[model samples]
Target: MGEEEQEDEMVTCKTNREKEEKEDDAIATEAAAAAPYCYPTLRFDIPPYRSYHFYQQFRNASNPNNFLKSVNWSPDGSCFLTSSEDNTLRKFNLPDCVDTTQEDTCSSSLEDPYVADLIVNEGESVYDYCWYPYMSASDPTTCVFASTTRDHPIHLWDAITGQLRGTYRAYDAMDEITAAFSTAFNPSGTKIFGGYNKSLRIFDIHRPGRDFEQYSTLQGNKEGQPGIISAIAFCPSHTGMFATGSYSQTTAIYSENNMELLYLLHGQEGGVTHVQFSKDGNFLYTGGRKDPYILCWDIRNTVSIVYKLYRSSELTNQRILFDIEPSGRHLGTGGQVCCIFC
Candidate 1:
């Protein structure tokens, strides 16, 4: 029972411990090696109707700590803006986009550092927004965006410098801004269209301090049945074509000049939170709150079926539609796990 026996036992215990540790390390290494190579990591699949890449995900770091409510891409498609219920707007750079890859993380770069900045800090809820049209190359203004707040006002700012360019408030003729959900600029950047709770208003941004004109009134629905017009979008390619979606699951395209409803396509299963047109104005994208999906409508066809992504999944719930890239390359959805669909 002596000293030699004790030393032998101690040596055996140490060896066993080291062996077990090595085994654990080997298992971990194998799992890491086998982890799927998810490029873009935004869309589940790729190619044809499946190809998509992750641009980036963002969150609010200001007061109230609410999730983002809206987003818009720059006219040049180089940057995008995200507005939040917390009353702040953020601008993110749209760096060179890469196609989705099916390689493992180790084969490609694990992470690429693309950065976005906080350009404006308006102290109110930012419900809707849009980037201004770029008219001339020599224009000093890099980008322009409008943020509509609960205070019944629209604040325009130089997206690049965060300088306040103009403020459009409601007059007596126009009822108090019930809910401003979406904003848009005509292709030439001369006019601004805003969709509100009970009506739609257009502004002349070319002239500073100009008042907004009430273009059309949206049909209201019964309480708790979707009365609020939540989103609006102007067609980039179709000069006078615009679209509006509300909580009642209806998305209607209209003529910007006469405010005439051109067509109403119904596919949203929940509140139609937002709608967007592709750069060519061939397809209209709508975001649904109840079903929580992104629906693509073929504008050319009279009753084309809706193409949707992420139907009723956890990632799609409460996902609000923001802006699309100027080239119509990507659409941004706001939520805890914000998404960019190509």
Candidate 2:
């Protein structure tokens, strides 16, 4: 009610607030001093990648709204290609790769976060992106990638300059264009293969449409012809062999020369979405829709799987991709909601 009383109350409230702030600061300082130092985060129990450091992060201002769709590593392990939903690819170079090396992949310095060195933008929304089987950042000509978009021609581009190198087009009997979901390059980089709804189309790089080969991977016509292929992985050893995984939970190895079905390894728990071969080309690893484990098979012996690498916990229809290290000892893959390494 009085001015003097109001002023005294205001001063007391200020004093209490300052006292609380000082107490909070003291508690935080004491907690920090009592905590123990943590070692650099790594997996010593793992084979080759016992030590992995978070070197950097990369962001692009050009396509801020698009989510990451796919990632493909270079053959030489120098750099990688990250594809976004906008039908664009970004090449994030590992600048410190020259002086460092890792047991599994080429190492980059733990300097400032790396930035996108080059951005390759195509006009259509990208369906799939694959690095040339022999891409190397050191050689500009060798730094190439293949991409496919729905209802659009498959284009191969120079990753360094983002220039269109070649286009592999497909036309139906009506002379209308056809769409594809997945693309791959032969180990020699002389041919391109695409996954259509029910078949895989092989194209010669020089003249894509002049003469092409088609192979059907559809196993069942009864289940509403769920014949769409999930992914394809080519053998890097040049053994004239490649593998195709489909929605029917079968992984088939095919002869590259005659396009003959060599062998079939079936009975996976889920629809095979992605397949990859080990560095030695002696084993194949596969991840499927709703599968909790990454299946590994010995190519030479198809009767039994070598092991099942554990992955994310859930039932998902999403197709996850996995990769093996250059040393052939470590394995990496992504799950529905997280990344897994085995």
Candidate 3:
């Protein structure tokens, strides 16, 4: 080959090699820059639950029909109760903080929460169950729980004796019984509230047959907002304030004085089935049916969501509910599939 042509060919080859090297370096740099943003992961620094007081089992070999539906702790924190699909409510007593017995039941995972305390089962199927707001083991006579049934009256049962204490009903003048989907007692335990399709009713605890007052859940007929409060919670310290979550995917705060709407908190893609205020009453956590995220909002600043935690994904066939620890150190929900402690 001619010297000039050979020299030109060698130079071209060297230039092409240098171009390929530059392209490779550029590709590597681009990937490094996109790594952190494209696939962001959820991280948490939640404290581990030091001890598991007890695990309440829902089902056993002989009792395979016990599917857990909901659980709630007493106002005094002395005990908690669970409602199951088998149409029964069971209470589990928690050991005192000073218990000398070793808490070998302690676990950080979602093990079968099996416990033995008390059981009250007499209903077709449970729609909702709650402990009386002032329920304390110290007062056995007054320590009771109330539940609503799809085809039965709202029965307030003595938690200690496993006997029916009272029954609240929402009936018409013609004496036709109505269905109650959810029920809760006022903070003072003087009155009971039942939630129906789009209405919330209040009845005197002494006389449970008729509602003293009925209030619609909608605010000024605001279209496409929270409807049919699936859950209701009253602040322990702030008796004048309470919150309700609806099937329309909204959580609302209201004042008890006049039952006036105070502040509305909205950020759920599915119907909110659970809502709870922290011990301090400054923050709230909400989760909904078919939604995997539990959103935490600051009542003081409701402009933006401050934090969020996830449970199972939308594919799961269960409605997930979350609860904060008594110490406020950790958060908990159903299913270990996608639930995080932090």
Candidate 4:
């Protein structure tokens, strides 16, 4: 064959091979893309309860006096912890009850929480309290609870025994110590986060660290009117997702791994004092000092607000308390309201 003719043939062969390769790759890509996606849908089927019919007025002795600031239930849902302006962190225990086996044999019903114990002392005004993770299976029944106070310090106490575990002094360089508003434990229970003033400081709880040996610095809003991050909560399902609310009347969903801002939730009227994720991590609830309403948002759809529970009104402000069951079935709010869903 002539040289030029052979060269042209060779080029044609190469182009055909390339075209075939491209076609094969396109087919493979489409096949992979067409694979069915599977995401577990959270079932929220339990019916809702009206504010009146759900929870009775828990006028138990352990109830915090004045403004009941924060509440946290134990891991097993056997008890609940609360901190209030009344200057105490108390533990209310579930009434003793036999397991299903014994219940079936005896034909008795399950018990409820009562004024079982006083976990913390009566002097310091506890602004927030968080139960330690993995508390149920711990060696002793003395689970840890972090109580942040206007006393310019965070006190870690044994929820069962009421013994002081450790005290984290407020950083002196920050001028006046603001009220420690919100406290939370990392999912692993190795670290604790305290929200105050303009800083969200993380501390090493297990190693017994000094005052606020902060490993991460999170500053939201800006100077002139630095937004005080009033409420902070770690995601219950995914370790990397967390939510923070501030005095600027905004809530930011951020990544815990790199602290990257994911979404900023707004439309509230006042500073957010508390933010929490539903047990399944599908929804977020936020409320605060001036906001007498609990705002619920769908995490997947950032722009959608699921519901709002009016905690107070013009005639007389009603203090609404709230809690979520571990099973994610029941949401108990203040003023005797419990919401249930599948």
Residue pairs that clash (backbone atoms under 3 angstroms), model 1: 40-54, 47-51, 71-323
Q: What is the Å distance of residue 215 in model 3 from its true position?
A: 0.2
lDDT of each: 0.66, 0.76, 0.76, 0.66
Cα lDDT of model 4 by residue, 1-342, tens digit: 999999999999999999999999999999988997544444456432211110112333565235555666787677777665557566777557635433232122233223448646655655567778778724554477777766656778876677778876556465644556678887888878787665677777854445564422344443222376767788889668988777877888877676667888886777776677998888998865556577899989988788887754212222334666656655655533344333
- TM-score-wise, the better of 2 and 4 is 2
TM-score leaderboard ranking: 3, 2, 4, 1
| Model 3 / residue 118 / CA error / Å | 2.8
Residue-level lDDT tens digits of model 1 in 68-104: 5555556565667776555667777654654456433
Model 2: lDDT of residue 20: 100
lDDT assessment of candidate 4? 0.66
The most accurate candidate by TM-score is 3
TM-score of each: 0.63, 0.72, 0.73, 0.65
Candidate 2 local lDDT, 1-342, one digit each (tens)? 799999999999999999999999999999998998453455755665423332233334764555776677777888888876666678877777443453434244455445677887777877778888767667788888888877788888887787788888877678888866778888888889887766888898888553677766655553222466667889977798998887777788889888877888876788888888888789888888888988889989999888887888346676677776655667777775555464
The model with the greater TM-score, 2 or 3, is 3
Q: Could you tell me which residue pairs clash in candidate 4?
A: 43-342, 44-342, 45-342, 46-341, 46-342, 273-288, 321-333, 321-334
Worst 10 residues of 2 by lDDT: 50-59
